[model samples]
Target: MSERPDISTPEHIRQLVDAFYGKVRVDPMLGGIFNGVIQDRWPEHLAKMYTFWGTVLIGEQSYQGAPFRPHKDLPVQQEHFDRWLVLFRSTVGGSFQGPVAELALTNAERMAAMFMERIGFYRDHPERFIQ
Candidate 1:
């Protein structure tokens, strides 16, 4: 393996997001849910993710939307989030280092926890999620 570099550019974010989603697209546990929700919109989803990570890691303000709303109703649970973190950490760990990489991992952990908690909340109170 080559020396990993810090994630400090749009291309780095693109690489990470692209590679991570590439894995997710084929993952048995996650693929069905993601592909079903995304289907022909993978490109759009990837672009949004690039912006989302760019903003989260690099302080860019490009992404502006509710990241959790799309995921609130997904048929996911702790295992799904666990798989996601494993895949994500492997992707980032395989190619990145330094503070940004750690930030990405930390942010992912927090995001997953928040999403899971929110999903559980909505599940217990479906009426709160009505549009």
Candidate 2:
């Protein structure tokens, strides 16, 4: 097997989003949820993700939207988030390396934790969480 390239540019971010979403689309665990929400708007969603990750990994500031709002009503569970992290880590590991890739993984893990907390998985400390 060949070594993965470093994720250091907007194009790399785009590639990561595209490849990751492609896997998500066919993933038995996540496919249903994503396909249900995204439906026929894969292009639009992909574009938004490209912009989102680009803005996140770089300082592009091209994306303009709330990242967590769309997932507010999903029937996600701990297993779902865990599975997402697994898939995300696999995708990133398979595609890239270096500080940018590390940052991507860190950000993904943080996002998963935040999403879980927001969706009531971590209700033990309700006072510390946002309303």
Candidate 3:
């Protein structure tokens, strides 16, 4: 049997979230979108993100929030979502180096693509994100 790699840690997940937001805060492509949203609540937001990613990568159910539902209320467009994927991929690529990292980023990319596609379709239809 193939052994599952011991490739994830809470600290690693924290690093990824911190590094990703650090990049996002500076990226001209995505910075404006996150500019005012994360100013004072960056620490809390980061904590939530860490919990979310840690749960995803390490099976720790520390995350508690409905992120997508709030995102639906935001002023984000399809382009914003697409750019989020680009920035997220770039963030992961810049910070991690390993097979696990590769797998994680690949999965993240696929999920983001699927999310954007679905959201885009829903936005175009206005009948799905509601249901």
Ranking by lDDT: 1, 2, 3
lDDT of each: 0.96, 0.86, 0.73
Runs of candidate 3 with Cα error greater than 4 angstroms are 1-7, 73-82
Minimum summed lDDT over a 10-residue window in model 3 is located at 1-10
As a TM-score, model 1 comes out at 0.96
Lowest lDDT block of 10, candidate 2: 122-131
Query: So what's the TM-score on candidate 3?
Result: 0.75
Candidate 1 lDDT by residue in tens digits, 30-110: 999999999999999999999999999998889989998899889999999999999999999999999999999999999
Clashes per candidate (backbone, < 3 Å) = 0, 0, 0
Candidate 3 per-residue lDDT, tens place, 48-108, comes to: 9899887777789999977566455456666776777777777666666677777777777
In candidate 1, residue 67 scores what lDDT? Answer: 92
- C-alpha lDDT (0 to 100) for residue 79 of candidate 3: 76
Per-prediction TM-score to the true structure, in the order listed: 0.96, 0.88, 0.75
| Candidate 3 residue pairs that clash | none
Clashing pairs in 2: none
Clashing pairs in 1: none
